[model samples]
Target chain A: MAQKTIAGVNLEVTEDGYLENPSLWTEEIAKEIAKEEGIELTEKHFEVIKFIRENAEAGLTIRKVGKSGIVDIKGFYDLFPGGPLKISTKIAGIKKPASCV
Target chain B: MKKILILGAGTGGTIMANKLRKSLDREEWDITIVDKHKTHYYQPGFLFIPFGIYNKQDVIKPKANFIPAGVNLIYSDIDKVVAEENKVLLEGGKVLNYDFLIVATGTRVDPDETPGLKGELWHKEIFDFYTVEGALALQEYFETWKGGKLVMSIAELPFKCPVAPLEFVFLADEYFTKVGIRDKVDITYVTPLPGAFTKPKATKMLGALLEEKNIKVIPDFYLESVDNKEKKIKSYDGLEIPFDVLTIVPVNKGDDMVERSGMGDDLNFIPTDKHTLRSEKYENIFVLGDASNIPTSKAGSVVHFAAEVLFDNLLCAIKGRELRAKFDGHANCYIETGFGKGSLIDFNYETEPLPGTYPLPGIGPFGLLQNTKMNHYGKVIFRWIYWHMLLKGKELPVENHMSMAGKKKS
Candidate 1:
């Protein structure tokens, strides 16, 4: 149970640095997290972050996000290089989804 | 009773032992499986240990647990295979005469083949994720270490799980980012191949992924030796890469028994028929997995697909019929890109990895050459399937031969 204070807001995080509470997420928090991940807060990145935050409770994935027309699979990779869904979800302040190993 | 001797009770040998035990007449045909060790390792799971994704207990089980009741599991080191006399000699002078033989003694990481790979700093700064102990050692090393230049390289080609090194670097990126020090750690991938992977299309795709992750790829650099004192790796072409942590996939060679048997190529891999899986020099012996010099990626899936073809050919040979089964070198791998998603690649000897739906034509829960969370799930789920279904010789839905139905051409 680790705590991280991002964008002047305090929130609980896991050892892996994923947000523990989805409700604590704000647009400013997403921008700060994205900046730390070496990604600028562009409209495209915001589109993904918003989509993930909206569907955060249902457990959204890159595939489902791709099918939702927010972005294609390749665009998802372009948005988040190493891991699109995981990074996006983290920036959106959602709990880390399981089955990622 | 006629004995069917199977060497090495690993994945392929265990499957053959279980499959043949049911197929052959139990009263007349006797099956004997031999290995030096009692524990059977789920070798694919070794990739996840360094990142704390899988523990040792999850990947290991007793060899006798999976072997069928009818098969005799002998724990002994092999001395040599006297192929001419159809006999296998154990180290303590136990001779086994067999009507048929299956060589599944898989390849092992030979760090000694390199000049300075096993010197001082072995397992400290230099680590290989191939063996169980090495993977565990790396787990400890990765923890409590701050950030620096982290390098992952392959000492040579023909290594087991050809995609593992790539997966390792990708996982490193995700792991470092998760630990909040990805910015401090610089990751570089050094390989002897011209691209990120062996196949052309896969190279283009995976190479791009590496570039996207900001992981530098030093391709076409043949490893000459390790400079242990200087903490650097020197390539034969006069190139050198220095790193604070070097995770290397060492030069893989077949069993020492293969070398002693005088039936293997220069690297001690048995020269096997590409299509039939039969031993090139012996009529009654067949080679599978990493033990065979079959110009294919020596991954577990290749062995699983080859087992289907090999078992049919073995049955035909036993009945004195023409061997109709031909292995098309069908190999599939689930590449973990970390962060909960992965990509799947399905290709044979001829076709390169293409973008398409997999296991279905128009519809797929999994995508080929497309990174998705489902592919990650597929990779994780495979561990369960491998132990319960694959090793027990149960039939899976996937075809033995590579299919072009769902794939897009280039």
Candidate 2:
């Protein structure tokens, strides 16, 4: 089924991430979610990607990170100098771009 | 001439100092390790203290005994770390400069973070196992009380040894059982999280155990205020969890100096690279243990594993090379399930504690997700590992990385 609109969208996003191959889209979904969170891409996504991917089997949800969103984005920016897109995409299962090295 | 200054001669600082000392030649580098306290603690042993398994004498020894022979050890409280200047100011009127600094200063409990916790009921009706005084006092209270509403709780998240609360409950069950009042006492576990643990498998397993033990599990209860006058805990959601005796894992924060230095997250944890164990903000600084805001459980084992990766990365830093070594937040812990049995979980950033044998898949020893005596032995024997191997930064025969070896696969 297609995603429900508006209020239902957030709940549907969770099911969408859960039903999809999380290892494949953990980065993508996390990035898309970060978009909704009013944040841009940065190296910080790498940490959350690995954390979410590893925790997927144990149910570390984007909703959960959003709920406990005490994680400082600026702190993350400081943590990884790599751009968020590169970090998120890589942890999302993309190869490390040569420039990142 | 490069000068290296290490703050907090505790587990993290001592290990980093030892590791760096081995890498930096004495002729070219000068290393100084500092802390106000002379005694070092096997903090993991703090869990066993309440059960009368560990005493003050057993858990502490001289910090000087652990520092390497050549490294200079300074006994002083650090005022702050000036990252821009690459210097640390001590409690005295002395300023120490360094070419590079490692902030291995780990964390401790701040019961004051919550109102009335440290106020009236501290060490009386309310207690924490995170410290020696709290655990020892709780032990005395445990013996004195016949039985009442005993609530085991965590004030907030990000506590060291997340499994310690579960272990406390399991052992509390046996403690009540041994005291011959298991039937009289009521055990209720309250937490901010929605389950018995952060991991689902362990929660389902432990939730079932709580049922078997007749213990109540209250999930998603954020503590709003502690009513010491009434001896009850009020949640933001307005759900009240009442108790005759309260055991809490108070809110944990990174060392205060992290805040003073202006190099920490809101919770005062240093911002560190999750994979490389390098400080993302400052190239010269490296953080390990509870000092970093890494998502891994702030257990000693995570530090033990991160130490090796940090060791390799620091070498790269010295050579002006890229930090190639990666840390996956590998933390392995044994969850004691009471009686003579326990559960073992070995996992990394992406893996959960699956049902499998550990370190050697399909092996004869150390079963995962299942309770066994060998795992119980692993829990008890970790004391030896913490003292002789971990604090010294010695490599365990096991791989520094998490292995899928002994784990069972579907």
Candidate 3:
């Protein structure tokens, strides 16, 4: 774990740059993280992010987000570009999805 | 008499029946186990079938053989569990009431979930080794395959026996090499995950091994559909890879009975308390094995370990005590790297697989995260252990919870 400053607040983060404490999340923090990933946070992005933050504990998956009624999987891929689940969870101020390794 | 109903007499439910029967008084309790199928498959051996290392007979036995005498075994299709009514409706209108319910209805591979996957070429050019039929079909196909673009693709995430796909390619490489068609076969592994595996360290190790075997890996390719006309698989993002023969781990979902009961997630896997193995919505209903939406590999090793935790917790619940045992999401897997060599990994919820020894520190007969002949033997001998020790709920040397004794933090 390493400490990094995001949105003028020092926070602990994992090696993958996921927030160590999701409770420290704010709308401003999400914007800063999105900017780091070279993505512009739009209202549609925020809708997916909000859904991700709320359901983070239930285990986040691209399939789950696709079925979230807010967006389809293709639209989600359009939102987060490279790896939708990985990027969206980072912007949502949550840990990366832990599938069985 | 009070009843304890266990559904799906596979590895998990069978073990639970044996364990609970020994602990609970037979005079006071009536234990019944039910499943539609009569044969209990040693699923781990299904991986060996395609390679001709084992056959259908080696992997299967009568479900009644492992079932204990005191427990009632019913071979009937399950209709649904009326959770609120504390009763289960069986096919042909039989009702079985339960004081407590244990759900162990494991997952099934649904090739139909993918478009054109079960199309005209199914079981001919395309196959899945997850089922007995699929394994046998693939074995027959491999017998005379001239070998070209043998693509092993995973259709979805969180499928049972996560290591099986990796093992399949490894074995395919060896089988082709031995049969003198190694150069002709263009082997590729396609998965939705970013790498060969989910965890960092294990991915690095396995990825290196795949490269060493001259296997090409196409990562981040989520299967959208299979194109029968073009003989290719298309990803959601419009990437397509042509294949001569496609060995797929199709979309795995929990039994339809779970959906009929109205007690499952989108995948039909019951929402379960990860630690306690109890159903999140129904207090009296507990979930075990692949049927539960737990963040762990859906493997027999997981069911074997989780059974111990569930046994303790269920005993506590029966005594009106707090559920004490917590399942650490422990899963042990032996990765068959082919050529009679294999690798082993031991991991839990919070810990990733570390390289070291297993079951013993500094003096392990089995190496962890390291490929060795001993690990291969461990996997081979596991068949005996599965049939004799594991399913019978006999105590093994390994503990239920994961131990970090021999593991080294990187």
Candidate 4:
């Protein structure tokens, strides 16, 4: 665990830069994290992020997010650009999706 | 007499039947098992069939042969589990009520889920080794055909026997070389995972082996559809790879009955308690093996270890005691790396596969994460163990919970 300041809030984060405590996340923090990942936070992105944050406990997958009704898989790739699930979950203030062995 | 209904007489269900029947009296408890299929398949043997190492006869036996006497075996299709009524409706209008239920329906490959996967190329240029038909078909195809681009793609995540595809490629390397087509064959592994495997040390080790064998690894390629016209597979992210022969682990899902009963996730796996192995919704219903979304590899070893935990918990449930036995998602796999050499891995929910001796600290006949001939022998002899001991629920020397005694922290 490491401490990092995102949007003026000191928060604990994982080695891969995912938020350790999802509850500490704010919209400002998400935008700041998105900026670091070279993505501009759009309302549409936030909608997908909202879906991700809500369902993170249930387990998030690219297939699950594709069927989230907010976006198709192609649209998701366009929004996040690379490694959609990994990047989106980072910006969504959740831990990286496990490999689900 | 109270009834104990066990569904799907595969590895998990069969083990439960054997264990439960031995402990529970026949006069007080009626143990009944239901499965549509008559033949019990040694699923691990399927990996060898495509390479002509094992045949259909080697892997198959009558399901009734392993089922103990005094336990009822009903070979029929299950309609759905009416958990509320504690009864299951069979296809032929047979209603069986149960005091406790064991769900071990397992998982199956659904090629139809991916568009064009089940098209003209299916069972022709494309095959899956997960089934007897697919393995046999691939065997016939390999016998006549000259080698070209051979692509082994995993269509989805959390599929059964996570190491099987890696084993397939390793075996292919040896098989083709022996057939004098090693240079002509181009082997590529395509997977949705970011690397050759999920873990760090194991991935590094296996990735190096793949590199050494000249097999290409294509990571993070989430397959969307197969372009049958162009003989290419397209990813959801717009990447495409052409193939001469495509062997795929198609989308794996639990039995359709779980979906019909409204008790499964999107993949049809039951929502189960990872530790207790009980259904999240129904108290009397316990899930086992690949049928449950347990966040672990869906393999026979996992089923075997989990069956032990489930047996203890179910016994507790029957006696109106607290479910004390906890399954830690212990999974052990012997990876066939071809040419009479193999590797082994043992882990659980919290631990990743580490390098060391296994079952006995510093004195393993089988080495964990080390490619050796002894590990190959362990896998080779496992077929006998599976039939004679494992299905009978006879105690094996290995502990049900994963032990860290032998594994190195690094």
| Candidate whose TM-score is highest | 4
Supply candidate 1's per-residue lDDT for B219: 78
Q: What C-alpha RMSD does candidate 3 show over the true interface residues after superposing them? A: 1.3
Error of 3 at B248 (Å): 0.5
- Per-prediction DockQ comes to 0.01, 0.05, 0.65, 0.72
Residue-level lDDT tens digits of model 4 in B282-398: 889999999999988999999999998998999999999999999999999999999999999999899999999978999998899999999999999999999999999999999
Supply candidate 1's per-residue lDDT for B148: 98
Q: Going through the candidates in order, what is the number of backbone clashes in each?
A: 1, 9, 0, 0
- Residues B1-410, candidate 2: write the lDDT tens digits: 78888888877888878887877899999999988899998787777778777788888989998889779999988889988888889887699999878888888899887777886888998999988888899888887789989998887767788888888988889888998999989998998776787676767777898788788888866565789888999864457888999999898888888898888765678878889887879999888878887778888788888988988887888889999899987988898888878898888887776788877768848888888999999978888887788778787777898887776555
Using TM-score as the yardstick, the better of models 2 and 4 is 4
Order the candidate numbers by TM-score, best to worst: 4, 3, 2, 1
What stretches of model 1 exceed 4 Å from their correct place? A1-101
- Per-prediction TM-score, chain B alone: 0.99, 0.97, 0.99, 0.99
Off by over 4 Å in 4: none
All candidates' lDDT scores? 0.87, 0.75, 0.93, 0.94
**Tens digit of lDDT per residue, candidate 3, span B24-73?**
99999999999999999999999999889998899989999989989999
Once model 4 is optimally superposed onto the true structure by TM-score, how far is the C-alpha of residue B129 displaced, in angstroms? Answer: 0.6
State model 1's lDDT. 0.87
